[model samples]
Target: MVPRRIICCTDFSYNSEPARELAVDYAKAFGARLTLVHVIDSSLFPTYVDWLGDEIDQILARTKEAAETKLQEIANKCGDLSDIKTCCEIGSPAEKIVGVANDEAADLIVVGTHGHTGVKHLVMGSIARSVLRTAHRPVLIVEASPLG
Candidate 1:
């Protein structure tokens, strides 16, 4: 059966637009609801330097605000084809993606992968991989064409 509800995860990166487009296409095709989620990675906070305190808090606050604005823009780009909801959360990307997908009762999850392999993949673990293993629903991963 075609997905009735889709959760599209976006980082607002240029490469991610293809995945968002794919999500928009699926949503329009299946007459499904769309939820565009952008997670503000909390790992940016200084872990060892406790003295940064207030400065760190301010950075986190501003980052989340920017994320909301970007998420709205991404939602708008999803076009006037389907019902689209925008969500911004502060946490780990994979955890938040999975949580939102389940909370929204999504039939499918859409994400973009950097296509990193071998050592690069190990050094920076893939969020899509984590979400794929953790999510209860199916996930669609979009990668850019090599011709570019």
Candidate 2:
């Protein structure tokens, strides 16, 4: 089915650029509402340190702000596309991506893979793999470029 709403999730890594480009192409081609999502993995925060509530709040706020700025830049670059939106949240990347897809009722989800394999894949895990497994709708995975 041609998607009326598309969710494109990126980690702001070079690996995700291809996915973003493909999302733009699909969105433009289908005249879909494109929602760009970036989740700041809260798990990345240091667990060993005891952080004060205010400090944690400040850090999350700063991170969210930075992510919003980047998302806006990406949205601006794709200004020709229709009904573009940006979402920045703090949570597990895979779960948050899926949540956004459900919330947006996205017909399609586009994400980039790090192209990791074997031990590396096992060690680093794969957000794309997780999303592919859990998402109720169609998912398009763009492999990382070889130049990287």
Candidate 3:
């Protein structure tokens, strides 16, 4: 198959790092353009606003700054790949990921699965699962283990 665009969604969790690695490897093997995306949950901003009061802007700024830093770190770790692109977006994680995949015309959506089960799955929900269900393109769900 011809190498096409691949979208990798990460939350910067320890578990998600393996997914990032796998996405990089797949991109390298296929010579595909890799797009690394991180979504900042919008729900988090309001919670901070209530607590931080007047400092909400500063908090949001810092949050974005940190996210950018982390995104750059991930991009750096992926090494020099001309085909790689990195992006940070704000909104629902699953929606933003799927939206980016669609907007970028990605051939596949790659994401990490934390393997949440039972009540934990119900409570935390699974971005991977949502993407798998909603994405128009093929989805690659990488487990948090093995880093492959």
Candidate 4:
């Protein structure tokens, strides 16, 4: 089946760079429309009520701006594909990514995994794994680091 649409979720981490590249290549190969998505995990931030008196708004604004810039850079590096789109969302990363994929009717979802094990894995659950488990569409999980 032809993948007419693809959703790529990125955290802009060094580990995720390869997944971004892979998504671009896949999009090119399949002649698919690509949507580059970045989700801001708001849970990491203090509650809105708690931050009302602080610089939280400013921080959020700055972070969004930076994410947009980085998303543009990623799109540019992916190639001159007119069909490419960029989106910045706020919520749980994995949930937002899946939500976008569903909302956009993506045929495939691409994500990067650090492949952490042991205590590390327990602490930081695998977003890629969660997506793979819950996504209705096909999911591609790229290991952040290369394997020997």
Candidate 5:
């Protein structure tokens, strides 16, 4: 089915670039509205530090701003799409992405994978894998091109 809305997730990493591009292509092909999303990993901060609340907030605010700016830059490069949206959220990347997809009633979820495996995969969980497993809607995963 032709999607009415598509959600593309990015960490602003090289691994996710292909997926972003593919998402833009799909959105244009289907005349769908594309929503580009970035999630600020809440795990990076210390939640138990009460004294750091203000500091954390300041950091998070800056991070969110930067993420939004980057998303806008990417959206600007998506050619002539009429309906492109940018979302910056704070939480687990995979969870937030799935939540956004559900909340937006997105017809499709597009995400990129770092193709991590072995110990690295064990240590740093795969967001794309989690989204694929948990998302209620259809998901399209783009694997990063292998490094030379």
Candidate 6:
């Protein structure tokens, strides 16, 4: 099916850069509006910091700002495409990515996979793997290229 909207998830990792490139290609080829997304995975933040006063909030704010800045940089690298959008969200990566896609009514979701195996894969729990299992729309997973 032809997709009119695409959401590409990026964590600014080396592996994810390839996905960004591929997503842009897909968006251009399909004539789709592309939305670049970066999930902060704020779940890593300590919620039970009872002793901290506003420090946690400050840290979270800074992290979110950094994420937005990085996302903007990536968007800029895509050139001046009027059809492009960027989002910075705080939550579990897979959940937030899928949620943004659903909220945007995206026809396709693009993500990068580390292609980890054995114990590493089990512990890290692939976001692309999770999105593949959960997303209702089509998902394009760009695995790390061997050449790179």
Clashing pairs in 3: none
Candidate 4: list runs displaced more than 4 Å: 48-51, 146-148
Q: How accurate is candidate 4 locally (lDDT)?
A: 0.85
Which sequence of candidate numbers ranks them by lDDT, best first?
5, 2, 6, 4, 1, 3
TM-score of each: 0.91, 0.94, 0.86, 0.89, 0.94, 0.93
Lowest summed lDDT across 10 adjacent residues in model 3 is found at 45-54
Decide which is better by lDDT, 3 or 6: 6
Question: Per-residue lDDT for 62 in model 5?
Answer: 94
- Candidate 1 per-residue lDDT, tens place, 8-85, comes to 888877667788889999999999999999988788667678888788778888888888888887787677765889
Residue 53's C-alpha lDDT in candidate 2? 55
Local distance difference test, each candidate: 0.84, 0.90, 0.83, 0.85, 0.90, 0.86
- Deviation (Å) of 51 in candidate 5: 2.9
CA RMSD (A), model 5: 1.4
Residue 1 alpha-carbon offset, candidate 4, angstroms? 2.0
Residue 117 lDDT in candidate 6: 74
The residue-level lDDT of candidate 4 at 29 comes to 87
Candidate 3, residues 1-148, lDDT tens digits: the string is 5548999988888878877888888888888999999998877777644767768677667887899898888888897676888888878888999999989999988898877779877644477878888897899887775342
Q: Write the per-residue lDDT of candidate 2 for residues 19-125, one digit (tens) a residue.
A: 99999999999999999999999988865567575788788899899999999999999958868999998989999999999999999999988778898776444
Global local distance difference test of model 1: 0.84
